[model samples]
Target: LLGIARFKALSSLRKKKEDWIDDDDAAQVPDSADTPEVVTMKEDKAAALRRFVDALPEEHRTVIDLAYYHGQSVTEIGEVLGIPVATVKTRMFYARKKLGEALKAAGYDRGWP
Candidate 1:
């Protein structure tokens, strides 16, 4: 179920490439302008990051989802998961390390968003 959902989300992201904008480029676009290469680069980085996050181990991914996606603090995550706060912090640390390594290896080592 999760895989299917992720696939659908990624497919939609690819289809709606122009909707993927950084904060600096959020202004309305003129119809006369061509789609810039920078847009493609942003999409590439987004796709790469998504792929890496999805490929993470379940434990690591859960920590990432709770902390980043759901905006949970370490203490909050620990409470929700019925684990110690220290454990939550450790999982987050390892998850971030793995994600950083994966993103760097995919040639998106700099300028995140």
Candidate 2:
């Protein structure tokens, strides 16, 4: 009985996460009130990432979508994608580098991390 109950709870949690993804897909961008660069840096990143999604490779794009849009942790993303956590982090690293290049080429003066 306890095993079945645990299974049911896990199933419900997975469904909830799926529902959240659907909602995220429907979410539209909101205009942020401009402030200083430091303040914007902390909160503006998700928006920035969304804007650059099309430029990402499918693997990096899916990982980021799971993490940000689906509100998943790195470990969760790893589990979902059947990859190790280290690999997920590597993809994120390369993804950031790619985005940095694109942004710089577009004339945005985003400073180094």
Candidate 3:
């Protein structure tokens, strides 16, 4: 069940282009449009996300890096990691849950959206 949730989350994220803005382009927003506080908030969120991922356990972190950073499918992750697809899914599920909790604790009260 959790694995299914993780898969859905990844699918949703992939479909929602607006949710994943490139930092370089984000920074190019007109000066008149962005307040300094907004810019700082973005930076802080990015930093927190990085720290969260970096702090994850190796097994969980590996699955996240492959799925999100490398754009690998669950089957592909299993192939690369020499694990079963189910195992990959489980790790991804737990990793995403931890990330959501961390973000929530960091003031992203909406959780994973």
Clashing pairs for predicted structure model 3, backbone only:
none
Q: Per-residue error at 32 for model 3, in Å? A: 12
Error of 3 at 90 (Å): 0.6
TM-score of 2: 0.52
TM-score of each: 0.63, 0.52, 0.62
**lDDT, candidates in the order shown:** 0.84, 0.77, 0.87
Local lDDT at 109 for model 1: 69
Sort every candidate by TM-score, greatest first. 1, 3, 2
Q: Between prediction 1 and prediction 3, which has the larger lDDT?
A: 3
Candidate 3: residue 110 lDDT (0-100)? 40
Q: Once model 1 is optimally superposed onto the true structure by TM-score, how far is the C-alpha of residue 112 displaced, in angstroms?
A: 1.8
Cα deviation at 18, candidate 3, in Å, is 30
Off by over 4 Å in 2: 1-51, 111-113
Put down candidate 3 lDDT per residue, 1-113, tens digits, no spaces. Answer: 99999999999988987667799989987767667787787777877888999999999999999898899999999999999999999999999999989988877754322
Q: lDDT: which candidate is best? A: 3
**Shift in Å, residue 17, candidate 3:** 33
Question: Who is ahead in TM-score, 1 or 3?
Answer: 1
Which pairs clash in model 1? none
Query: Where does model 1 exceed 4 Å of error?
Result: 1-35
